[model samples]
Target: MRSTSLTTGYDIAILGGGVAGCVLAARLSEDPGRTVCLLEAGKDYGPHQQAWPQKVLNARALPRDDVWERHAAVHRIRARILGGSSCINGCWNTWGSASDHAEWSRAGGPMWTAPAMERFRRAAVEQMGLRAVPDGEFSLWSRAALAAARELGYQEVDMASPDGGPGYGTPLLNSVDGLRWNAAFAYLDAEVRSRPNLSIISGASVDRAAVRAGRVRGVDIVVDGQRETVHADTYVVACGTFGSPAVLMRSGIGPASQLRETGIRTEIDLPGVGAQLVDQPGIFVPLTPTADLNTSLAAKQASGDLYVSRMLIRAASALCPDGSWDLHINPTAGPPLFGRLPPGEYEAGISALLMKPASRGRVRLRSADHADALDIDPAFLSDPAGHDVAAIRSGLEIVQELAASAALKSLAGPAADGHPAQDLSDQELRDRVGTYWHPVGTCAMGTPDDPLAVVDGEARVRGVSNLRVVDASILPTAPAANTQLPVLAIAEMLADSLRG
Candidate 1:
């Protein structure tokens, strides 16, 4: 697995071949003069194009057939590929709140803001066309939600601009030819992949950043068996918040006390390295719609109505902010009861998502191993009394109103959990609220004065030179919607900074 040429020791070394890594490699290699080495711990997606289906079920949920099962106990995500999580991720591309970006700018991420993010998104969508259809069936849930909002007298929430920050007009999907087009196919296509300047090494796990004179000179990576060093002028730890922290801790560059406990010497006492994790709360409410929505959806999809339905949802803004996730209300077309079916049984679920959660959590190394998944304490519901709770609670109340709406009520039965269709008590509702799968801010980009700051606004790890973290780890907080678009935009912005 170790193939090296005297000239291949690149100008830049990118760890983690995810969306950010692919974009950086592509953009960096665009300048043929520069040498870039993209190292992926996961297997290359070059073999299985079948994993690129737009539908969730068709895409490969697990990693490579060989490596997936081994790492199952740790990271539940299907991240062992060139495209990273984008490969199996739902293509919900709704860019989150401008206010969230503004907060990042104020905290430490100076380059990230609504306008900058929008500009980056514009570029990305220009490359991957955005579809927004108001009457489309994919957006039926959103339309229903909007109708519910209207009926309840609550200010209708847009996918992007939850409280008038940025307006999410349509559902933006990462699809090419109506099929799922991940970073491997979209950003790092054959042309980029074939570049001589860009050398991609898959299945190579990075152990630690080799620090000399307080600057990153190379990395200690475990290839087939023995350890080797890959030197680079600039080292970008796009291994994500959790991965970055774990690598840093392993490299003896983290909290002094924690390092001592592991019997490792301290390189840098960055207390905030694994602190300040953030994710939005998720709440789902089941509705007994008048019709069998799931069966109808399956039939329509089978009948070539998939595109039409998706297009309709796109236009309506019912889809998640950028087609990165879905949060519409649709009735289940299949059997209502898991055990036995009641005739004409149907249930549509309405979900309340914070999109941008104000709460933050932390990621800590459970062990010194870089391959080990960090102990993630997302600390969901960290601030139950904060605005975070208010937003989620408001969304829940809105869904209840929507379920009671004449349009849905005329077609559906009473709102229930399906087994027994009864109204949930206030306590029952609060207990049921959960997470939306958007975890960020472990290595938050903020100033040292800020308690939650990890990397500075420039994405540079505080007190460390020649090392930059360019992933969702640097997010100051969770965005209003799906994080892929924002994370990609941040990487683009980081690439520009690195280029300069």
Candidate 2:
């Protein structure tokens, strides 16, 4: 990794120290010759981050005073700490379809295509201390669900790359010791933080990307109630889907009309900087467990099934190369009352989400103030083409079928949804199946002629110099599964491009 000079003048300035930025920082710092400065608007991962190992536990605890929680928004999903969303996100590391990537390439972001993404995926997954396994640990409910799918002639497979086809398998989590593993802990926490060339500045909110002469020069930041400026020769914006666009528009680097209307000067004419946002619509199908499998402190300690299940999951990953959506099958103490439950409450209920969503949405500025939250038009049920509605509704159908299966019936009872997963008409299901919290796009990858593309496959900002975006925002479409794995791949590919 490259080390920056103490003089504060560096070769590269990476804004947003989340998963993408942290990975980029670590990868760029590998050179050790060039100076790299990583600026995080949040704080370092402290005791809070180190405490929880399970994603559920972390999710339940993240809203507190932890540095990770500081970056969260009431309507905005994701952690704002050094590791970014990965810190608080469920550690389900699954990839999407090659079809998804092929579409991205065709859409104008060629680097995101499966072939190019493979190398990056290898580097990120291989180096990040995670390994694919053969047999995944699934709860009785989960296994029954897969078995039900199989009975329906849906071939159950891991979502991994096998025969170079669009594979499916269990997810590759960022865990080490039955605990949650995010970007800060996986790569940056130990490596980058220890580097003299890399400096992590947390608790500082980036007002905007500082621009001059149609190029990014630095960032205007507010740290500890004091305003300061930092510059670098090359600037990379890793501030995330919303943050990147927000910063760009505030810096006068976005839509001419939007900027002018806000009394902000236009630095570039790119109108797509904050458009085309895509995320998944999340819906839960609740069912009653046939057997009471709720865990107690004593039951948890005595249950060898938990450990065996996890190992089996890892084994499945090793054995199967075709990555199907990984499972987090567990015996819930009880069903979620308000979409959430205390750690051991849910009784044998499973939370199933489409690992990748085919829908797309957009992010736009509601105002100019740094503290003012941006209005995110996730377009969850409002896909421009209505593909989102169909996909999510189909997913719901799949869930219903699984819930009604004989195997699942033997363990868990009929599925029910207060939001009417069953009662809602097909159109209603499409309208209501909401976000899975995975937001992408708003900085699409397309050709120069493409009006909505903000960056190309190489992550270069369209119509801008010395500036690039390396986050989920570049995705032309969301994957068919969870997002962490794909984002890791994106970071790896962008870093390799920078190195080359």
Candidate 3:
């Protein structure tokens, strides 16, 4: 990490040193002559894992430290660290179905086709050191979940492969011995950090890009209460889904009407800058574990081998496209996600996640101040056609069946509430909805003809010559799987394009 006072002009400036930003810095800095600066709004903690906080390194639980907003709404939580959400998210990785790529290809041209992006996906997997769940890591509850899935007739398939259809499988993990291996550990290792051409500046909050005459000449960032402009020939925004659009809106490059409301003069009338927000919403069905199951889970926890979840079912609802799944049936047991349990006791539950939802949301700025919170509405289960609600209901049916399976019934019983999740009304379902934390599509990708497209297929901003957005924000649609690996692969693919 370098001091901002010592920073000067560079060939390229990569904003937001999250997962994608780390990859971009490591990849683009390969050419020593092309200087690159990577800026992060949180602490870097250096390149060594020992220097990172224990909570951030523990893969057994999601850490709330070093996040953008402490104690904020659960759905609005995002990391504010050098490695981004990878430092705090579940260490699991899974690829999306072929239908997800089909949608991406439609918006971003042939480059986004599954076949075209296979190499980059492989590259990200290898670089991240992702591996299958070890037998030791599987708790007694996880074993029962797998058995229940098989009992329900779901075939075992490779969850990390894009060619697979509906099935039950364990996702590849980016954790080794319960230690989270975040993007900084994978991409910006000691060797990469030694590169003279690459400068990583942490605790630098970006205000906006200095856009002049359809080009970004510099970016205004505040560091330690002082503002500075970092000049660069090119700029890439990798601020994840939420932060990316907020940055663009602050730059006066969004809907003119909304910008005016915030007292920001519109520099570019790009309606898509903060529109079309999407995220996966799910409902959890809690189960009461048997005394025997509790004992086994306590033993596993004492042995330091307890993991909340290890396997999941990729299931297709009746309304889902043929040969694709729209729901993820996850069986989790261990420590509760929200609160602590009594000694020797554990929380168990299964979640039904609506993967491909028809509902859309928006991200809008409340005021011109960068410190103000942006209005983010996920709009889950809000589709006019009721497709999203119907899909979730179908998933709940599967969850009920799984709980009733002989394999699962012996380990746990139904919730005391005695209410079948599928029987819930529309309003009830909405009240209980939770996010999968996979948000995308605010700055969607599309061709020039698309009125709402924020960037072109190559990730170049429509009206800005030297600025691009390379992150989950440009995904156009949410993938069926978690966004971690896909975001890594997208960054790798776009790094190649930017290099060319």
Candidate 4:
């Protein structure tokens, strides 16, 4: 990694020191000659700091308030810290299916073919210290869930496997020694943090990119209650789906009308900046577990041993052909509740989400102030193709069925929802549905001619220079698994491009 520099212009200014930015900063600093500045809006604590917040480091689960919680009518969750969502997220290190990448490759980014993406996936997983739990440690519930899926003709497989074909498997996690191994721990570890060339500036909220003459020159930031400008030779905006667009629009880039309506002068008329907001639609299917299930989990939590909070079954959607995978049947123990047990309660449930949602929404400026929350609308289950609704509802049916299986019945009971899963109406499903929190495509990947294409496959903004969007926002479509793995893979691939 490069050493810290006492220079005015950094070689690269990475906005948002979350999953992508942290990795980007560490990798880019590898050049040694280039100076990289990583700016994060939350706390950036050292690994050995006397008081690393337990909520940020524990392997239990993510805290609910650890991210931006409210957006329009949806209860959104976006990590605001240096490690970003990965710090707060369920550490399920799973990848998109090969077919998923093939579709992306066909869609303008031939470079993202499944075969080509393997290297990046391997690298990210390795960097994050992801590993599978030993067979001996698999929770009885998880093991029983896997057995039930197999009875349904689903094979058991690791989600991180490159083949990535549909199957039920114990999720591989980055956490080690009972601590959630986040991006900061993976890329910006002790050795990387001590580097002089890589400076991490946290607790500073970026107001906007400083764009001039069709190029990004720097960023306006508020730190210590004082505003300052930091210039760089190039800039990378990995500030997440909502934030990247908000930053661009605040800098006078976005839908011209929206910017003008928000009382900001438009420097670019890229209406696509915040247009294609795609998010996976999901909901929890709670079930009453057999007695002693809660007791076992509580004892395990008390033991301080790594516990299985997540076990997933990746299956093709009903809409997907025989050999394609698209739905994620995530049966989690403690995650949705974020590990906060309510006075001896410890029942687990399934969170079924559509891997590929057709519904599109928007994220636009609600005000000109950077501090003001942006208006967000995921518009989930509104897919004209009815794809999202069909996929999630189908997955939930399986969850209900899986819950009813003899194997799972020994571990857990029937659905505890007001109505049985099969009896759920479309409107009831919509009302019950919540987000999987894996949102992307707010800055879509398409050619300039595409009206909603804010950025191309190269990750460049359609009409801006020296600027790029590298987080979940640029995914042409949602991947077939949990998002942290895909985002890290995206960052690893982008690192090669930026370094090259």
Best by TM-score: 3
Q: List the residue pairs that clash in candidate 3.
A: none
TM-score (C-alpha) between model 3 and the true structure: 0.99
- Cα deviation of 174 in candidate 3 (Å)? 0.5
* Worst lDDT 10-window in candidate 1: 308-317
Ten-residue region with minimum lDDT total, candidate 3: 1-10
What TM-score does prediction 1 earn? 0.81
**Candidate 2 accuracy as lDDT:** 0.63
Q: Would you list the C-alpha lDDT of every candidate in the order shown?
A: 0.61, 0.63, 0.93, 0.79
Candidate 3 error regions (>4 Å): 3-7
Scanning candidate 4 in windows of ten residues, the lowest lDDT window is: 332-341
Q: How many backbone clashes does candidate 4 have?
A: 4
Candidate 3 lDDT over residue span 192-245, tens digit each: 999989999999999998787899978999988988899889999999899999
Q: State every prediction's TM-score relative to the real structure.
A: 0.81, 0.83, 0.99, 0.93
| lDDT tens digits by residue: candidate 1, 1-500 | 22375224778988888878877887878888898888888767563466443342232122234333343432233366677767666455766554566678788644666665566666665544544432443434444444544454543234433234322244566754345567766677766777778888888788887675789877988766667788888888888656777777777777788878777678877777777777666666655554655455445445443331121111112322442322332222233322444544333464566665556677777767766655776655556555555555555555565567765565456555353212544455446666555677777777668754667877887666888888887887676567777777777777877888
RMSD after Cα superposition, model 1: 5.5
lDDT of 2 by residue, 1-500 (tens): 22232236778888888889888988898887877888887666442554543443342223334332344443366567777877766466656655577668887556666777788887778766665432423444445555655555554355444223322235565654445566777677554566776777777788887677877767788877877777888888888888888888898877898888778888888888887777665555666554344443224434422321221111111111353332222223233423564555454443334434444556667778888767776655664665544544555555565566676667667545445364666567655454556778887778777888888888888767888889988877776556777788789888889888
Which ten-residue region of model 2 has the weakest summed lDDT? 311-320
Model 4: pairs clashing at backbone N, Cα or C within 3 Å: 3-196, 3-197, 4-196, 4-197
